[model samples]
Target: MKAKKIERKVSIALLFSITLLCCGGGQSLLAQANPAVFQIFEKYSKQKKVTLLEVSEELMAEYRIKQFKSIIFEDGTLALPEIRRCIEQDKQDAKKLKEATADGLVVSGYYRLKTVDPAMNRYLIFKVGKKNKVTLLYIEGRLTPEELVELLK
Candidate 1:
């Protein structure tokens, strides 16, 4: 039970962090549409703004799977395998993810400059989905790995 609670906190924290950076732009209703992502993140862990290290198209797919796992775990009803089954069923969604990564997803991920006075660098990453959605908002300085991963959660 304690473990579950910890997991849930982490998810929330990550969601909150993403919201801070991603949604502040002129009414990006995209977040509203992706509520499942927020809810899942909210339910599984704490919001954190980690320094983005790097990102890849391949990583985006794994990231999607990880988010789904976190959500499934919180539900207590669906197993990882079940979640995988659901992903497999979404052929269209999978295709979109793949296509997105191919186009806009930066290989080493985009860099986000965070902090001041000896600024810290964070890498923000994105995945293309037959379109470019990487710059969802005006990221401050350079995007770090964590910032790049903002869209994923």
Candidate 2:
């Protein structure tokens, strides 16, 4: 009976360790999977409400790109009608390069804004999550669409 108790206790401990390893490991892997995304958020961490307009040239000229604009929810939710419209427009005009979904969150691929001028071809990426959380990143300049897609992947 003592031997059986020891074996059961060891089994329980092993199961607990595995559970923690799986849960913690997945988050680290996800964070590392796209360090650039995290970096972008960290760069703007001071902003109380980071809207697409806040990053505009009229506001923060340092991060401005004339051809690109972003729309983010202050509450991290994307339930706004304007945001929905913009996303739909992007879906219609931009070419999707890659996307991934886990749990209730979705990270879509970099899209080259086709509706814009060819010389100003901007890249857009979006992260949509549960509870109306959404983040949009707009990038412009010499970065090729392929490079942007790779960064997003």
Candidate 3:
């Protein structure tokens, strides 16, 4: 009887642990999966000639996006190199969905990050435009890879 009681207790504890992980652990996983690009946003968002847009999931529901964040640097003279380094680091573990290069440098790229939740998809998109302007975008949602491409159009 004592052995049975111990087994039951262990089962309950295990179940409770799994419940907590399913309910509360997803956010931490998402944050952990975010690339180093967030540093760029924090460092440059308040600077002059920088534009930042962060839209909540609730506001982006119509677009099927759970989260949307973008930062644009008009003169990327300083930030471009940092952004490139971050992207290179992020690309190490991500799937390169699309990419463009100019003068042997990555001018634009789209990547799908490995995520814990199959229901949630995460992506990183970056571009370098005229006058060295740079744009970086991060998106999360349930959209398929093909759907994301369509939405970008």
Local distance difference test values of all predictions, in order: 0.32, 0.55, 0.88
Among these predictions, the greatest TM-score belongs to: 3
Q: lDDT by residue for model 1 over 17-73, one digit each (tens)?
A: 888867565243342123122332343334232121223334445433212112212
Instruction: For model 1, state the Cα shift of residue 139 in Å.
Output: 13
Residue 5 displacement in candidate 1 (angstroms)? 56
Question: Residue-wise lDDT of candidate 3 within 18-87, one digit each (tens)?
Answer: 9888769776565546678889888898999999999977899877788889999898878888999999
lDDT at residue 2 of model 3 (Cα atoms): 100
Clashes of 3: 0
Those runs of model 1 whose alpha carbons end farther than 4 Å from true positions after fitting are 1-27, 30-32, 46-153
* True-vs-predicted CA distance for residue 7, candidate 2, Å: 99
Error of 2 at 141 (Å): 2.3
RMSD of candidate 3 to the true fold? 4.2
Error of 3 at 87 (Å): 0.4
